[model samples]
Target: MARLQSSGFFDLGDGRLEYHFVGRQPAAAPTLVLLHEGLGSAMQWGALPETLARTTGCGVLAVSRQGYGASSPVSLPRPADYLEHEARAVLPRILDAAEVGSGVLIGHSDGASIAALALAEGEARLRGGVLIAPHFFVEEVTLSAIRRTRAAYERGLLRTRLGRWHADVEGAFRGWNDAWLDPGRRGWTIEAALTRLTVPVTLIQGTEDAYGTRAQIVAARRSCPPGLLTVRELPNVGHEPHREAFADTVAIIAAFVRRVLEDEGAGEPHRPDGAPMGE
Candidate 1:
């Protein structure tokens, strides 16, 4: 593994957000912003971020959301407005503090939703985005899986493994699980909001993902500005494609980022059929 670095925290008003920076900084390469899943923390990513950073030559910023990892505990139930806050409120501050003028965003699951919302306004600094196992709409299977996960946490060995990553595994689990299962959140769909994003986006989903279906990809393809979007479905993979097929995930992302940057330096910023960046 590339030499790993110590993790730290950034005060974001409500709490201090935990994060880790990997790869050589102040390098002649684009920055790569990484957002973890609902139950993820900086440590949970393990060696993936470091490996990707070393290969891509991009400085990696991997972060745990407010209520997860070594960050502050969630004081209350997750707000229905959490995703919105992540986009409009939280992310800008993070980018500003990091001094990330422009780069790519790699978001998984809940992180994908957050990235979609955050990139809607199209910061000029943004190069592109890669979303893995993103969740825009809920599936019956997903809720069922979450229920199963809760049971496993209670009766199975889920706690033993998760405890190593999260300072308070219960806080992380309840913050995501409870908010998602809340009946009021059932109708939450971002198809309309996502349609407004102009950034070049690549959505990756597993063919076997039980939490989402082809309908989710179809919605994203139809909603996003045409041609600027790409979708890749990996066969025989599940919800956590990055974990199940790590090399493939990294390869696709690396290629997409390099291509976007190359196109930006050319005349147009997208394929002929797709809309330009920030359209």
Candidate 2:
């Protein structure tokens, strides 16, 4: 039998956000919540969500955040702590509305950063996380790459390509592009919050990722420790490892989720707010 696919919008109080489920109806297992890159969306994930669900026996829920895809358009120029706010407040609301009580987060680029922040702040429903090319702190390479992206958007290719995935293409581009380029956002870093993360984390980065460096992997490893952290570096790949290395990425994600479920089943405690218990 063919699996089902469906899409919908959630009224997140602040605004509406678009989301889709590619595999099971109610989203299964500790649902694999997939978060998109800055300019990417649920559709932009291509077949990965469905593939992940099949590979891991979990439901894959992908959301288009605030200003991307079929979601509401932004007013331009998001705040520096935009990701933090989403992680701390908005994510829980979305999850509650969707009726997903627990999940394993798989985040890419900006979405990855949001995953890290959410975990760090002790989001209790999160069993673990798979962060791909996540940035804890601002880096020159990231800013530079984003600047180039803005130039490309201005030149047309970036926007035109983004249009296929986003309903408000300009809002998607400028919201992410403008925030990172803002000088005030340069001081942004979740390094301190990282130490508070108790659940396991898997960090996947490409050696050739222009937006970030191995420094992110190194830092996450240092803070999260050996048992709690897993690092995977794909050689000769760029920003989007999941898109660029689909087969390998799915394999890693499936294995990581299995490990997390095993560990949790053994009775690792969590707080009332859903954050993992202890550091």
Candidate 3:
């Protein structure tokens, strides 16, 4: 199995971003780029990076965007179009900095929305995407959940927990929470972005997710080209399916990753146990 190649902060000129790279990308295989949730960082990804590298024989790069993890904090009251900005402006720079020749993005929550937007706008190196609990548009459930989270943060419960991972926990929380709760953002939607996807995409969502409902899934199905999209809804699971159902999530992702690589003529992916993955 490939070992951790490096872990440190990458200077983006304006600010440094934290990153953890596992394994080296083989000439034939695409790198798996992990985009964390709103409040997540490289460290928050836990064992997913290493496990993905070992299972798929591919490199994995997990990055923490500005205002999260050990990265430099951003000014509060982020713009409503921040997700679009990240997708079009920030993500390309990150991909360039990482020197990712070819990649598959695996994103969760806010990161998933960014990934979808990036794919829609077009990124040359990106072959496909695995989006977990992505929000295509604003919903009452999403606003209500953020309000409850805001209450928890105000009560110091959420802050204390998130403090363990972020150096500026307040910035991380407020940046995400404030943006979502912005009344102007009530009309926020990436459904138009979904319609522009040229590459294949796999969307994974949990039926029990409090932040979003099946309507999000319905939006994707309605917008994206039917042949290019795949959907998986897990029963009895929540927003963080990777953490809530690790093995199952990994299996599903690995299968899709292999299919993507195979379509690129990169060859089959093997299980950590050394057996070839079934189609």
Candidate 4:
């Protein structure tokens, strides 16, 4: 039998984002807001959300950003700062309109980069972050993989596979692909924002990941408050650690969220100034 899922759109006025609110909510616990990968959507997360919510007793709100999934398409040839722009302009509004209030951010790939940006910019709604295969800065490996994928996209396989998850597949593909391939975007880095973030962050990536190196986590750890950061390298895993090593990934994420929330509840300052970051 086919299972039916219920979902709705968050009308942000500027854009309508496809999202689904499901899983357990203990009231005392914060929600787990999930951001999908570049070509991902609310549907691409598969059963991970349900599994996490059940295990952690946290509410789960999975968002499909504009130009991906069922959400509206964005303007073409995205700015070099689109990820940062998303953090500053779009995510906060989504949090506000979705009534997410506050939550832990669990993001993958491009989504992970966006999560770090949101944390850096100080999303009061974000208590912590779980970044998987996050690219803090562009690298040769990153472009190489993307270029290879672009070739595969031209062969029709990539587009066909991504089409299953995206509503505007071409828009999503071009928006993410073209922006990264732009020469000017090579200098882009969200590392500077890390200095402003004090939240507990778990940076997990597989050693086998072709797109980015462990240096991605190293950069984050170097930039973020040492005491607030955790780095985990999953051996034998690929880019999608959460999916490749589901049990370990979920456990690490749940523990990080719990510990951070407990410390915050016990009155530890989330930021050095005893105020939210990015004032």
Candidate 5:
């Protein structure tokens, strides 16, 4: 199994983001970079990082963006185009700071949307991506869920639960919730970005997700290049498939990572006897 190499703060000159690094990547192998959901942090990923490293035989790096976890805080009422800004600007810097030469982005929810944008806009050495519960456009179901979340936050239940992981729970909640629920941002959609992706992508969605619907997958299938995208729908699973269907999620991701590497002729890490390392 891959062991945890380090866990600490990563200084971005302007901010200090928390991060966890697992295992080690060889020169030819790709690193797995995990991006969390809107209200998630490096700690929120739980054991998925270590499991991915062990199953794929690749290094795993999970980082918390600014305004969440132990990272720096942001001003209130974020702009409607914040997600786009994150994709085109912040993500590239994170990759460069981590010194990731080649990578497969594994992102959940809001993170998934960011990954899609990065792939479309261009991130050198980005091999491919696995997007879980991504949102391409604003949906009424998403808004309804956010409203309920806001209610819970006002009652203090949600805040108490999220406070365990986030240093500034209010900032974490408002930064994501307020921006997404803005009426002026209702037309937000990344379909144009999806159309520009040149690398392979796997999109996973739960059938019972409260925040989105099958429309998301349909839009992705319609927009992405033919034969470049793969879709997986989990039966009876909720939004957090990584936690709800841990083994199945890991298996699917591991297979995709291996296939991408093989297609790129990057191959897999080998043992001393020349057999595949993760076999």
Candidate 6:
């Protein structure tokens, strides 16, 4: 895998956003765009994105959402409306600036939710997606994990460790933490929005995920069109399947990309509905 560093700023309707590109593959090769977890950043993905790109012979684009990593920090409270901004505003600008024609989106945790919403919103530019440990609805385990993580951030080692990579660790936590824990946010659900996505999708989750349950996975699959959904449940894995079961996770992504590419007949991959793949 190659290590490449690149950053760009693009203006969304609300404000400017920044993103980081990890690896650039042959133009003819597929592109793998990564959307990090809630408390994650480009650097936090560690080497998974690079390894996946190398294994699949594709480019890797890992973004630092508006308030995380090297991007601008969140100056205000993140509301339920924020996910819409991500689906409609931030993503398009990043894709345009990167000049990514078509690609697979690999999203983890909160990133998974954003990816689902993005697909639900419909983008002609994306081929398909790999959603890992995603949440479509609030679960007890999720609330428990958030509470535990909050405690860790407040008095445990998590904050110190994560702060090493995130320039605005507080902003990162606030954007995700406050929104989910808000009493009024318990009803937040993306199932309705996700059901509209007609793209081929591979949902990856761990049987032992600390933050979500099987029901979340069921909801995600049920939201998709029949025959367009694939689910991989890794045993003894947790929230970060790509890291906990790195080899298996990489293999799954490689297979999905290959399947889509082959179905494209040496051209662009297509959605389950037979729409051309690309942005």
lDDT tens per residue, model 3, 1-279: 223347887788998999988765434356898999988999899889999988787778888999999999998889888889889988888877777778899999999999999999878789899999999999999999999999999999889999999999989999999899888998888898898999999999999999999999899999998799999989999999999989989999988998988896666765545466653
The superposed Cα distance between candidate 4 and the true structure at residue 98, in angstroms, equals: 1.7
Which residue pairs collide, candidate 6? 124-278, 125-278, 125-279
Off by over 4 Å in 3: 1-4, 26-28, 270-279
Candidate 1 least-lDDT 10 residues: 266-275
Candidate 2 deviant stretches above 4 angstroms: 1-5, 25-28, 266-279
Candidate 6's residue-wise lDDT over 43-133, tens digit each? 6777787676556656788878888877777765887778767877788777776666777788998888888888877787787888999
Please give the distance, in angstroms, between residue 20's alpha carbon in candidate 2 and its true position after superposition: 0.9
Query: Candidate 6 at 87: error in angstroms?
Result: 1.5
Residues 1-279 of candidate 2 have per-residue lDDT tens digits of: 223347888887778988888544443345778888888887788889877766665668998888989998877678778998889988888778776766889999989989988888777788999999999899999999999988999999877888888888878888888888998988888888788888999999999999999999878877774588889999998898888998888889988887787678834323223444343
- What is residue 260's positional error in candidate 2, in angstroms? 0.8
lDDT of 5: 0.87
lDDT of 5 by residue, 71-134 (tens): 9998888988887888898888877777777899999999999899999987778889999999
Computed on alpha carbons, the lDDT of every model, listed in order, comes to 0.79, 0.81, 0.88, 0.82, 0.87, 0.78
lDDT of 6 at 108: 92
What value does the lDDT take at residue 65 in candidate 5? 88
Give the per-residue Cα lDDT of candidate 4 at 212: 97
Q: Which residue pairs collide in model 5, if any?
A: none
List of clashing residue pairs for candidate 2: 123-274, 124-274, 124-275
Order by lDDT, highest first = 3, 5, 4, 2, 1, 6
Q: What is the C-alpha local distance difference test score of candidate 1?
A: 0.79
Q: What is the lDDT of residue 83 in candidate 1?
A: 76
Q: Pick by TM-score: which candidate is best?
A: 5
Question: What pairs collide in candidate 1?
Answer: 102-125, 227-274
Shift in Å, residue 117, candidate 2: 0.6
- Pick by TM-score: 4 or 5, better one: 5
lDDT of 1 by residue, 100-172 (tens): 7667888988988888877776777777789898878777777888888889888849888788888988888
After superposing candidate 5, which stretches have Cα over 4 Å from the reference?
1-5, 25-28, 270-278
